[model samples]
Target: MSTILFDKIIFGPVHSRRLGVSLGVNLLPTDGKLCSFNCIYCECGLNEERRTRSKLPTRVEVKEALVQKLAYMQSEGIAPDVITFAGNGEPTMHPEFGGIIDDTINTRNQFFPQAKIAVLSNSTMLHKEEVFQALNKIEDNILKLDSVLDSRIRQLNAPNSSSFNFDSLLKQLCRFNGKLIIQTMFLRGEINGEHIDNTSESEIKGWVNALKQIRPKQVMIYTIDRETPVKNLKKVSGEDLEIIAEVARKEGFDVTVSA
Candidate 1:
């Protein structure tokens, strides 16, 4: 079974395929996962295997740890391209999420004001006014939307709610007014004998139309780059990702391909 990948609240000035030289801030416990979706292609492992460890960190803990880390990096003369909010679970799930973002911005301004603040949100919390406000304050606000079709979303993300409103979520994303970056994962896979592939022509056709509605500033098309919980899954090729990116580009949207 795949276990937790991020073992600390603040981790790495590591290289990122999309966002360069990132320092990750994990709001959830390093040893466990707390997420709204149980995606088969998740690098942190399946939800069941992920919840057996540490508790979520408090807002103060996050602020203190982030500040300490930033200070250390400053002393070491290490410059990060971005301070990324990503880890084993959703960053917006934290109780004082808006407050946390504010603290992070303050710290970033003090230490690495040149660096960008980025959030890898699942878009589940966009319904919350505070969550939306916090995300809007950042430029690299990456949001996930694997598919526009509800059936495909269920198969791909396995969201916590069976009542996941497809239209409502899309509308919320549209509210970003093309300011958000759309992150789409393209893959072909089988789980428990069910074959699923979001790279199909029909799916892409609908997805392109959906992009037209959301009017994202950029669409990040990527395939699985790490081991996933589901062994049957396969990553879409770089060439294929560019093909999908081209479709979105033709629709008048800038895109980044990370295959």
Candidate 2:
């Protein structure tokens, strides 16, 4: 099984396909994976394959790192478009996620006031009051909603929870009330002898209805951009993405397509 890890508390000034030049903050373990879902197309690879022994950064450590990194960037006259929360796993899984976001906001204000704070979550932890409140405070609160069908969601995200269902997740996501960005990963693949393709007509139709009900401020559709754990997976073409974008547009949502 193939797997990858961030190996750092704070990493990157890398170009984000959707968010532009952004800095990454990893609140999960620096050396291992700790996510609620084991996505087949995750660029970081399989969850069970994670092998790093590093631990999650403390709130203070994260705060200090942000201050130092931001201070240096400011001193050098460099500015990042966004400070994104994503790494090896679920950032909201961190015990002090709320406090860390608070620290990050303060540090960003002190050093890079122009930068926006963004968090990319799997949407599973929104049930936690602290996670919901913290996400509500951020400029970009991106939540993953990979498919509309519960069966498809099970095959795609491979949620750790046995009770994870599409309807319940959609209801939880609706709590954001159009304030969130819905991120969908488009791809075709198979796992455990089951052929999976979330870009199909039925899948797209289901996704459209879900987006309408959620009333997300924006929708992000993207395909696998890096080596995935499941090598059988196929990336959806750019032309095909435009076709999907039209469906989202007709559904009355701003769309961003990343091929």
Q: Please give the lDDT score at residue 124 for candidate 1.
A: 89
- Candidate 2 residue-wise lDDT, 28-75, digit = tens: 887678899988887787788875577778999998888888888899
lDDT of each model, Cα atoms only? 0.89, 0.89
| Per-model TM values vs. the true structure | 0.97, 0.97
With a 3 Å backbone cut-off (N, CA, C), the pairs that clash in candidate 2 are none
How many residue pairs clash in all the candidates, one count each? 0, 0
Compared with the true structure, model 1 gives a TM-score of 0.97
Candidate 2 local Cα displacement, residue 197, angstroms: 0.6
Give residue 9's error in model 2 in angstroms: 0.8
